[model samples]
Target: MGKIEIVEGDITREKVDVIVNAANSSLLGGGGVDGAIHRAAGPELLAECRDLRSSTLPDGLPPGDAIATGAYEIKKVKWIVHTVGPNRHAGQTDPQDLARCFSNSLHLARSLSARSIAIPAIGAGVYGWDHETVADLAIRAALAEQRERGGIDRIRFVLFSKDAAAIWSQAKLTHLGR
Candidate 1:
């Protein structure tokens, strides 16, 4: 299994093979992690997103699904794997959908032969999923993928705050028994 680490830092600054964006269905750009990624990656990222929308994901990406695009200006990152998290207020209460956000993103990262990936607290942001639930599901899905897929060498859960980091750390200990 790949090693899992929790870090309190900006996901944009993570020098990993890929950075997982907790994107909305639009996939164009939005607040929080999505907006920060786009901003750090520059306009080239937006252009690629537009091209993706024009050709493949024209109607926008769906919840629990993921797609990859060039990382553009983000240094040391080869690809940006974007996955739409299910919004609880939108009646997406199923935890499986949240799990898919991690599983699908990790699957795509493995397909790209990414050895390291940095992911944020996906559904815990604007999607309104609680931190504990998000952490549990994220860790479970990532650990499962690491065992089943085995390409990724490192999985880093990058959070924007110390509290978030602490929550993820506790979740990791609870789920992974470390």
Candidate 2:
């Protein structure tokens, strides 16, 4: 295992073994992080997603579930892990479901033997969960998973905005004390 790290910046610019896409259950591109990931990864990414939807994932999977695809334009990673986060409804996020997204992503990365992975604050965007809370959940899940599996070298929380970036930066200090 490698030293745990917390970085503040745009996910698209981060160099890691893989980056996660907070996709909709349909596995097709939706708004917020989902849309941005698809757009950044390029049209081929959308095409591959559509091809997967047409065959591999016809009816769509449940939230907190994830799938893998080839990294399109993102230079650093060889693969992209796409996971559907629980939509914010009725008030707070479902803790178990939200955590599943993080855990499941780590599981996929571990299975792929990835040395490092980058993730965004799941459910923090249009889902409207508090950034600090979501980042804590993400950090906790990744650290826990890595502790058990023993392969993941690093986890990066890539933030799209400065406010969200600050939330993760503070999260690192509060939770990891680093």
Candidate 3:
């Protein structure tokens, strides 16, 4: 089984095989983690998102679904898996939708033959999801995917704040009874 870990740092800096972006449906980049990732991954990432928008994902990506794009200049990562998390403020508060963000990202990573993935706490920031709630959903969903696929060896919950990281860390410990 893959191990899930939490870290307090910039997700863009992680040396994982893939980094999951908390992207908006447009996949064109927005504030929070999305914008930070776009900025770090550079313009090539934006161009790929534009291509996705222009072609395969013409109407933009939907919430809960995930897509992969080249990481471009972002060091140490091969791909960026973008998943649009449900926006609770917009009445898209279904836990299943939130869970899909994790599961689908993992699915994409497994498809990409990724050994490790770094993910942000999707929807827990400006999207209005409580940190603890997101942590629990992410943990459960990721574990389920790992069990089913058994391809990824590491899943990292990367947070920008120490408080958020601590919340995820504790949630994992509690969920796994460690």
Model 2: lDDT of residue 24: 80
lDDT of 1 by residue, 1-178 (tens): 7799999998999999999999988888999999999999999999989899999988999999999999999978999999999999889999999899999999999999899999999989779899999999998887887787456889999998999899999999998766
Per-model root-mean-square deviation over C-alphas: 1.1, 2.0, 1.1
User: Please, what are the lDDT tens digits per residue for candidate 2 over residues 26-125?
Assistant: 8778787778777788888989988998998998867788889988887777788998777777454678888888999989988888888999888886
> How well does each candidate superpose onto the true structure, as a TM-score?
0.96, 0.88, 0.96
- As for candidate 3, its clashing pairs are none
Least well predicted 10-residue stretch by lDDT in candidate 3: 142-151
Candidate 3 C-alpha lDDT tens digits along 86-149: 9889999898899889989998999999999999999997888999999999998777877874
Clashes (backbone N, CA, C under 3 Å), per candidate, total 0, 0, 0
**Model 3 spans > 4 angstroms off:** none
Model 2: lDDT of residue 96: 82
- Which portions of model 1 show Cα errors greater than 4 Å? none
